[model samples]
Structure formats: structure tokens, C-alpha cells
Target: MPTFTSNTAQINFQTFGDQSNPAIIFSNSLGTNYSMWQPQIEFFKSNYFIICYDTRGHGKSTAPQGPYNLELLGEDVINLLNHLEISKAIFCGISMGGITGQWLAQHYPDRFNYVIVCNTAAKIGSENTWLDRANLVREQGLLPIASTAAGRWFTDPFIQSNPTIVAKLSNDLGAGSPEGYASCCEALAKADVREDLSKIRIPVLIIAGQQDPVTTVEDGLYMQHNIPGSQLFEINASHISNLEKADDFNRAIQKFIV
Candidate 1:
């Protein structure tokens, strides 16, 4: 396991295939970690250098106290790349990670070759909604809504076939640090990248899960409309569509990047 420490946080990361190959950095959804990309890693490792890391306060990473925003989160990625001496790479992100990808493309265009945003949006939700959810989580841990969230995240068939994955996701969400999670809630609440879309000049691929309630196909459409010449692909899955439809997701990514 490779690791990088900076700015009072430690990010645990894994590298697949070879360093000499072009790097494809992956960022996972909120409450999940690099392990969320497990399905795609093996498939891409032979052709591309893969980098997956636990975002701050997720997975093996330490939970640092933060009122985290997109800029800070984006900086974390930049710092990791700097530490690795990586000049540029492709960015692949899901959900919250997708939001981060948009931010990176907007604020740090020189550092990325392409960005793949899956199941995310320019603005996550209203500030009040996130604040309310954070307060609710603070008052009553995430355990209560774990099943509900999971239900919305995956299709019924996926849940039926992958009970263990569902359980792990529930555990991850339920076990998240309240402070960290709350901070991210604030991040999501305040995030809006529509105006920044024009700043990104790199090729972009927007993949949306058609059934995602949190960030629907409309969200991907909005991104496609906003970013110049951006591409969109919709799959018949829920929020964590990459897991439910990994083959399609992987194929789309391979085609887009090439």
C-alpha cells in the first residue's frame, strides 16, 4: 500500500500496473473509498497505470477535522500528484468524486488530461437540504438511513446478487466520522460548478446512471450542455452505476479516453 501525507491528512493509495504507463487517477463516492473502484481496476491495469486513493476521512485515510470544500479536496489530489511527481493524468470520479473532478477541471486545468464524471452534478443539492441531513445524521447516526441510501444507490437486482457489497457500503456509511461527514455535507451543499464549466478545456466524458435519484440523468445532461463538446452516456443503473454496470462503465471509459 502506497501512502502520502500532507496538510495534516494521510491518504492511502494503491498503484496498479506500471508507473511508466499513463496514469488514470480514480476518486470514489462519498462514504466509500478506493475499494469502490475494485471492479474496474483489474480490467484497466494492464493497459493503463491506475491510481486509487482513500479520500480524506474515507477508508484507510485519517479523519481530519475539516469544513472541507471543493478547493481543498481538489488540492489534496494536486498535492498527491505533486508528491508522486506526476505532471498530468486522466481523472475518473464517481458521485462526490465526480464533483471533485469537475472542480479540478475548472481550477486546475493544466494538471489533467481528461475528466470522467459519473453520477454527479454541478450543484449537489440545496444548502439547507445538506445542512438538514447533516444535522439529522449528527442527532441520529447514519445507521438509520443506511438501507434507504443503499436502496437508492443500487438496483434491486444488484442488491439481490451482491448482499456483501451492500453490507460493506452500509458499514462504511454508518461508520463515517460525524465531523468529517458533516463537513462533506457542507461541501456538497455549497458546491456549484456550472459557471466554472467553461474553464475546463480538456476532453470530458459524463456518464450518468439513468435511475439515480440523487443526481439524475438530467444532471449529466446539464453537464453535457454546459461543457463544450462533452460526451454523455446513460446506463440503466442507480447511483453507484459503475458497480452495477461495470462492464458498460469500463467500456465507455476506455473508448472515451482513447
Candidate 2:
């Protein structure tokens, strides 16, 4: 476990495989930690230097209070790279992580060789929706929202067949830090990068979940359309498509990065 200070945050991150290999930094989703990227480690470690980190306010990282924005989240990654003496690497992110990826791709183009964004959107949901969620979490807590959020994570069939997995994920969501989750909600609510798409000059791969209701396929399509020469691919799973369709997701990433 490696740790670094990023502005107001203390971030926890880890690396795998050889340092000589190309680095691929991974950012976690909103509630989950670096563990969310477990499915990718073994497959990529042999060929690439894998970097996985718990995002600010999640997992072993500090849960600083605030109305956090995408810029702050992006800065966390930049600061982490600076601390590690890493000049550049490939970036792959999912959900909240994906939004962070977009911010970096637009704002820190010099820091990445390629970018991969999965199950995310330019503007996730309306500000009011996230405000409502932040209020609910503040008043009641994550337990009340965990069940609903989990439903949006995986398809009904997958949930029915993988009850244990669903339960575990729901528990993870329920156990998230209230202030962390709420602050991220504020970040998501305020993020709208539709104008920033053209700023992505490097190669990009956009992955969408065919069944994702949280960030619809249309959202991914919008990014694909706006980013010049970007490619869009679809997975049969839901929001957490990487877990639900690990083999396909891994294969797509392996091929694209090569």
C-alpha cells in the first residue's frame, strides 16, 4: 500500500507487475475502492504496469469534507503521479472514475498516452437529482440508497443469478463514508463537460453498457461522436459492466491498449 498527499486529500494506491512496463493507472468508482479494479489486475500485470488507487474519500483514502468538483478529483491523480515520479501513463476509469478521466483528458492532455472511459457520461444526471441524493444521504445515510444504487449497477438477471455478489456490492455501497459520498455527489452534480470533448486529442476508447440505466448508452455515444476518431464499444452488462462481463471487458482493453 503506497500513500501520497494530494492537496487536502491523502490517497492510497498500489502498483503491480514490473515498473519497466507501461503504466496504466486506474481510478475507482464513487462508493467502491481500488478493489473494484481487481478483475483487471491479474490479466494486465504481466504486460503492463498496473496502478490502482482508492479515489479521494473512498477506501483507505482520507474523506475530506467539501463540495468536491471534477478538477479536484483530477488534481488528485496528477498529484499522485507527481509523487510517484511518473511522467505519463494510460488512464482507465469507470463511473465516477470515468468522469475524472474526462477531466484529465481535457485538462491534462500531456499526462496520458491513451484514455478509456466506461459506463459514464459527459453530464451524468441533473444537478437537482444529485442534490436530492446528497440531501438523502446526509439526512438518512447510504443504507437507504445502497439498494437502489446496486440495482442500477447490475442487470436484474445478473442480480438474480449472482445474489452473493449483489449483496456484497450493496454492502460496500452501504458502508461508504457519508461525507465522502455526498461530496462526490456534489462533484457529479456540478460536472458538465460537453464542451470539453473536442479537447481530447489522444486515442480514446469509450465503453458503454447496453443495459446501463444510470448512464445510458446514449451518453457514451455522445462522447464517441464528439471526440474525433474515438471508438465506441458496447458490453452486455449494466453499470458495473467490468465485473459482470470481465472477460469481454478485459479482452477489449487488452486489444485497445496494444
Candidate with maximal TM-score: 2
Whole-model Cα lDDT per candidate?
0.87, 0.89
Prediction 1 global C-alpha lDDT: 0.87
Q: Name the 10 consecutive residues with the lowest summed lDDT in model 1.
A: 141-150
Best by lDDT: 2
TM-scores of all predicted structures:
0.96, 0.97
Cα shift from native, residue 1, model 2 (Å) = 2.7
Native-to-model Cα distance after best TM-score fit, residue 16 in candidate 1, in Å: 1.3
Q: Where does model 2 exceed 4 Å of error? A: none
Full-model lDDT, candidate 2: 0.89
